[model samples]
Each structure stands twice: as structure tokens, then as C-alpha cells.
Target: MDLTGPQLCYNYTSNVIGPGELKTFKCPASIEGRFVRITKHTVASTALRLCEVIVEVNADTCTILDLALNKSATQSTTYDDGKDHAGDAWRSVDGNLDPNMPVGQSCSHTDQVGHQWWQVDLVRYYHITQVSIQNRDVVPHRLGNVSVEVSETNNFDIHSEFYDAKLCHYYEASDVPASTLLILPCSDNIVGRYIRISKFVPILYDVLSFCEVIVEGGDPSCIQGTTGITATTTVTENTTDEQTDTTDSPEITSTTISLPSTCPCSCRGSIEKYYNRSIESLLDELREELMVSKKETASYTRTLVSVDDGRTSSRNIGYVGIVLLVAVGLSIVVPDVVSLAMYMKGK
Candidate 1:
């Protein structure tokens, strides 16, 4: 009997996953070896589910139809006719219909339709690092059973992986993963082109369904939009004085000089030249000292004469001393001569 082939399946599974809705669907055992492609996808932005279907075929087994749970991306399908879906990337839902269905997971949803489980792999296109899912949106939605798969090639399961539609452009990662967060090794520095996020439970309206996705490593600016600093100082005042060598403030080193007790007139002249003054002042000071020391001799005569530059003029001490010495010489000689003449006349 011509039982089952590809593309031919039961009624296309439909779901109303909102605030309070949940359901599960499955194909009969007779539909093995067949493929099921997504024809329609609709769900609110606040419901938590992994409700998506796909006839999964992997390894050495026949195709098995399954559902999904808590996934990364949300509703609003984009027809591959080169045009993306015209609706919002996420939707809103109210789960008033059902409340017992479980939630879906991102980059990690495994939908079990009966005796089999289906897993989505993101190795082919995405080098995923962290998988974050949360429901913080003001408009809560539901996540139906969604399926995901990965592979290196385009189609045809390549060893433990399923293939997804190829996309171009880097998807931004989340900061606060407003819903649920999954830390993944493949997420940090992931590099892929496609990530299909579908529903998990056909019927569990876990209200406030959300998923936050993040990549691992690369340009932090490109991922998180951040940029990283230095510091500096102004010129300081030098402690060493700048005027030390300036001509304005001459530096005088200590020095000492010794002179003999007495010298010829030449020495006096030299002393006067050293002081850059006339010798009259020096001689006046000496005369004053001599008059004070010993009352001037009887032969000493007061003489008034302008010396050179100023009032101290010349009271020549040397001249005074010479005059006294001559007077003493004459006095001694006269006494001796008078005695000798008396002796001669008496003889």
C-alpha cells in the first residue's frame, strides 16, 4: 500500500498560545520517513511555550515528528521570497485557554511528541555563547512547541544535526535577558547565519513568555555597544632655585687675607688702591690715635691742610713722629757739646 511520503501530512498543527492557552499534537506511527515543514506560525509575545512541529530525521533513524519548548526567538514568520515577515519580531498572548503545558527553552528546546524526542542544534550557522530567555515585555506571549536543528551543510541531516534556513547579518545579544537566561559555551563567540526559535508545548500558556539571547566574545562594542581610559598630570614647580647662577645675584665664596705689621709707602698706596680711596683718611685716623695715645710732643705743631678727597685731609702722623725724633736728637747733642766746651776752656 502507498502509505506515506514527504510533504504529505495531517492537518497542519495550529495553536493559540496566549496568556492562558496550551496544547500538544502528534502524527500517527504510519507517518514515519516523512518530512513536515512549517506552514504557519502565530503566538502572543507573552506566553511561554515551545510549540513547533517538524518530522525529525537524524543519525540512522526515520523521521520523527515532535514539539518544542522555551526557545530564543519569537513569532511572525518571514516568507523566504527575499522579503521578511511584516509583523513584529515578537507577539502578545493570553493563556486563559490552558494552564498545564510546560515552557520552552532556547538553543536547547527538545520536543517529545510521544515515544521520541527532538533537539535543535545551532552549530552549523551560529557560534552561540549564552542563551537567555525571559518574559519582561509589557505584552506577555506564549511559546508553542518549536523545533531547532544545526548542520554544516544546507540540508540533509549531517551527523546528529538538522538544518535551518540560512540568514545574513549578526544578531545582537541581550544585556538583561529580561526573561530566562542560559549560559552557553557556544554563545560567547558564536558565528552563525540562522537560528530558528519555535514553540515547545502545543498547549501550555505559560504567560509572560520571553527569551534573551547573547553572543560570547568579539568586538564588545559591536555586541554590547561599549567602548574602554587613561589619566594625566600638569607641570610641577622645580624645587631647585633658578637664580643660583644669575648675574643679578652673584655667589661670593669665603676668602681670607693676611698682611705684615708694617710696609713702606708702597704698601700704603697699595692699601689705598684696594679701598679705591685717597690715603688722607688713613693718615688722619692714625694722627688722632697718636694724639690720644701720647700727648703730642712739645715740637708737635697743629697744621691745617686739605688732604685729597674729603675733610679728614692729611694730618701726616709720620711727619709728626719725624719732627719729634729730630727735636730729641738736637736736645741730646746740645747738652753733650756744652759739657765738652766747658771742659776745654777750663783746661
Candidate 2:
């Protein structure tokens, strides 16, 4: 296999994995590979086991759509001719479900050793639904306890690696043979471009093999659905003021009128102009009334002063007439009294 390719898509070193349990992994972009390998890295005596591997090609829903069909396949070690050969990896994804194929005709086989793996590349990113693997018709007992991983990169080195990938699914073997296809569906929307199937247990024969690996899902670009729409709105309002004159009670002057749209500011300008004209008219009327009131007050004050002066002059003329009458009476009475006294003394 291409050992110098990108980093691995998934890796597991835990020894607590039990039989019949499921595990999963995912990536963010596309991965390119042809083999998925497994290796025994833990201290447990359990053997590294794998029956099949699959890659999703559509959304997060498992269906008959296998995106890994006709894709390339590679392995860590291949068996010789007449034995389980390496080229059998492609036949699993070839969509031929003929379980009755002759030995080594429908499945790929690897040497019995540690750190063996198989990988496949899907070319581009896909919204993976689930991966399904079919166990070999012969010796299904060896296909137990395997680690499955998916990633956007091809770095197979599980140790000291950095990439965007995740374990979307995993499975622990049971005593019963995995004779039928084991379907490992992705839980969340796990997207990836590549898939890896590996074994990391130290069993008696640490050989990694599988009959078929089927990836079911679709391309990320062809997604179709509805989305939300956002919008914004603004509103403007105009107001009017009215003034009334109760003196003559003319038709109530109303400033409310239709605004003309000659420019953006024309409407507002017209309203302001009407208000200014009305205020100016009101001010002019008030000034005229104040002038008239001032004139009337001045005329009334002048008439009052003239009448008071005439009364004072008439009183002064009557006092002078009374004083002249009293002086005339006193002078005549004294002269008559003096003539009578002189006549009586002579007699």
C-alpha cells in the first residue's frame, strides 16, 4: 500500500472494546486511498479483527447508494496467488453480491501479522449516511473485533498525527460469525472524503481480511432544501397643526395637506413651511391687535386728563365770586352804621 500518503482517518488504542459493540468516525473533506488497515497496538491478548469496511456517499441516512463503488483499494500485505490475494479488495465494492463466489474470488486477504489495515478513497467530500461491510463466505470467525475510521486526510500513521477526522463507527466481534452484512450507520451528519478499517488486537492469527466494503451516501454539492429569508422595513410619518380665530370664526385654518414628492426632503420641507407660515400669520395678527389696543388706551387717558382739568378750573372761578360778594357786603354795612351813629349824636 501507499505508506507515504496523507495521515490516517481514524485510530483507536483502547483495550476495553467489547464484542458486538459499534463505533464510527468522520472527516470534513475528501480522502484518497485504496486500503483500510488494522494493527494490534494495545496490551490485550485479543486479536485484531475485521470482516468488512464501507464508505458513505450521501447524507446521514444509510441506503443502497454505495459511493465507494469502482473506487481503488489497497492493503498492507497481500496473499499469494491461489491464496487470499490483494486484488480482491475491489471486488467487494464492485456491487456483485454473489456470496457463492469461489475462495479468494470475492474477498481480499492479508498476511497474519500485527498492524495490518485496508483503505479506500472516495475522491471528494460526501455527506456520509452509513458504511456496510460483508463478511467473507469462508472463515468468518477471523473477522471479529475491528476499528473503523473516516477522515479527509490519508495519513495512516495513527500515532503522532494531526488531521480533521473522527471515528464514526466501531464494532466488537461476538462468538457468532458475522456471516451477514454488518451495517454501521453514522449518527450525526458526519462528513468525510476517505474511510479506513483497521485491526489493533493481538489474537492468534492477526490477519486482516474482508469480502466487501460498501460506502453509501451522496456528494456534498448536490444537497437541496429550503432556507430562511430575512427582511427589514422602515416607516416615516407626518403631522399637522391647526389654529382657529373665534372673533369672526372663519373656516378653521388647517395645515394638513398632501405632500408633494419633488425630492427626498420635499415632503418634510413642505410640512415645515406650512407650520412656519401659520405661525407668522398668527404673530402678525397679534401685533395688529396690540397696536390698536395701545391707541385706544392713549385716547381714553387724554380725555380723562382734560375732564379733570376743566372741573378744577370751574371750582376756582366760584371761590373767587364768593369772596368778592362778601367784601362788598361788609363795606356797605360799615358805612351805613357810621352815618346813623353820627345823626343820633347830633340830635
Candidate 3:
């Protein structure tokens, strides 16, 4: 498994692909990024586990936007232009320009909720792929329709355009696969001047909800190609003078093993821990067997000692006489030591 893209997402092979084996789905990689909050989302029906949900983004390069109050691009007012927004009623779908957004004017919005959006140069962060949003809006906002627009004109703002999302590209539950990973690719490491992420309805209906937008800089799900295979060659000596014994010669045995299928999304980690624990248990069993052998050897040694003590034969009596002689020698040494000390003291 390559840990290059994401530690979690990887190519998974099913071992039982032959017959009526059940199919399995792999989890997506984690993305870390900035967020906007939505308060509503319903309980998911899929049994798949999301190991961890994080949006990844390079902050020094991302541009944000909020249209509630911020504006972008302003220049010398030209009311004489036939496209003046003040001259006609602006519809939600009509590309209208506010007086505040001229050709050179730029603004920023720090929402009371701290949703800071970039008002000027919205194109700085345009491309997006794989959008995972959590509708913190409490209940599904009945946002059956949403519009995503891309414009180069700096005259319009995104806030006045939320309901105006008619011309923009957006997706719905019917259009998007439910309870599955949403794939978006336009969010790559791209550079642009304007990007507008507008939705028709906030996914949250009653309460405010948090929605996560994920833009992939690179193929976060790309798996590295399997490396080349390398096999070591064993050199065989034709003959050897010390070959009198070949009883412990090494042997090569090959066994086929099937890969195990674990939920990478649900459980994050290596299966080696399980394998190591098993090997430890086997080693412990072997140790127990060795302990049993040591006990048997000790029991045999005790039997031999007992048999020697009970023997009345010549060998046994010879040992007994040698022990008695040792005792007499010790007795003689004790008296000599006392006499030597007494003579030295002239007692």
C-alpha cells in the first residue's frame, strides 16, 4: 500500500472474486481545508464508515468569498452605460452589477459568524473536485435546485446571486450519487481570477448547518504504480569438503495466501499488529513446552540422586567412605589450627 496520496485511501483487491462473493467499496482520502458551516443534515443510510473527514487546502493560495456585504472591482462611475444596474430592475438570474462593484473596487466580508470571503479577485481559487458537504442546516434545506456560476466580469457579487444561481452548474441528490464520496476535480492546484461557488438553497432548512467543500490540488486518490519485482539469486557450490552432514540444509517452500479485506475507512492502521500478536502467542507456547522439558529433566536428576542414596552396592559404599574420610580430615585440620594459634601465643 502506498502512503503517498492518503493514508486511508488505497487500491483494494478482493480475494474471493471468483464466485458469489459480495462486493466491497473503498474509502476516500482525507482532505484538509477551510470551511463554511451548515447546521442541517439527515442521518446517512449507508453502512460505510468515514474514517476521518477533513478538507485539505493550501491556505497561502486559496481565495474565499461571501456576497452578503463584500464587493469587488470598481472604477469611475459611468451611468451612461446601457448595462447600468440602476437603470433597470435586476432579477435573480440576470447578471446585474451593483454600484459598489465597479471596474477597480475590491471589498471583503467578515460575516458576524466569521465566514470570511474574498471579495476581490475571486478567481484566485477556482478549480474544484470532490465536494463533501455536511448540511448543518438542521434539516435538508429542500435545496433541490442549486446553481454554480463562473464569470470573468468583476461587476457582480456572490451574495446578490445566491438565489440567482439559475445559470450556474450545480448538482442535486438525483443527479449525485447518495451516501457516496462526491468527486470534484476542478479544485486542483489551479490559478484563476474569478470563481463563484453559489448554491440555490442552503442544505439546512431550520437550523444553521456546516457544509464542507473539498477541492483536490492533485489526484488525492491516485495510487502509485506497483514497483518492479526483484528476486535474489542463490549461488550453489558444486561440491565442498565439509559436506559430510547436510541434514540441516535450507529448503525453499512457497505457499499462497489471500489478502484480507478490512474497512480502511472504519479501521485505520496496519494488520501487522494482529500478525505480531499471533507470533508472540506461538512463541509463548513454545516457551511453555521448553519449561515442561526442563521440569522433566529436573525430575530425572532427582530420581538419580535418590537412587544413589539408596544403593548398597560397592560404588555407593565407596562414595560413603570418601565422605567419611573428608569429615575426618576436616576434624584434624580444626585441632591443628588451634594448636598453631596456642603455640604462637606461648600459651
Candidates 1 and 3 compared: the better one by TM-score is 3
> What TM-score does structure 2 among the candidates reach?
0.43
Query: How would you order the candidates by TM-score, starting with the best?
Result: 2, 3, 1
How accurate locally is residue 162 in candidate 2, as Cα lDDT from 0 to 100?
21
Assess the local accuracy of residue 306 in candidate 1 as a C-alpha lDDT between 0 and 100.
25
Each prediction's Cα lDDT score? Answer: 0.34, 0.61, 0.33
* lDDT of candidate 3 over 64-136, digit per residue (tens): 2121112232211112233332211111112211112222121111112211121123333333323332222
lDDT of 2 by residue, 1-347 (tens): 45586657777656455333334556445555666565667566877675434454333433436788779876666665664444355766666543433633666667756766677788886767678777766566555677666776676445422255567677777311546786787755556777777775376564666677777776543334311122222333333375534454333433323233221221344444443234447567779877756446878878866774457888899899999999999999999999999999999
Question: What are the runs in model 1 whose C-alpha is more than 4 Å off?
Answer: 1-87, 90-126, 137-161, 164-182, 187-191, 204-208, 217-347
Runs in model 2 deviating more than 4 A are 1-64, 81-87, 100-104, 158-162, 175-178, 221-347
TM-score of predicted structure 3: 0.23
RMSD from true fold, candidate 3: 27.3
Clash number for model 3?
50
lDDT of 1 by residue, 89-135 (tens): 22222211221223321111222222112223333333333332333
lDDT of 2 at 98: 39
Model 3 CA deviation exceeding 4 Å by range: 1-131, 157-159, 162-168, 174-194, 200-209, 217-347
TM-score of every candidate: 0.20, 0.43, 0.23
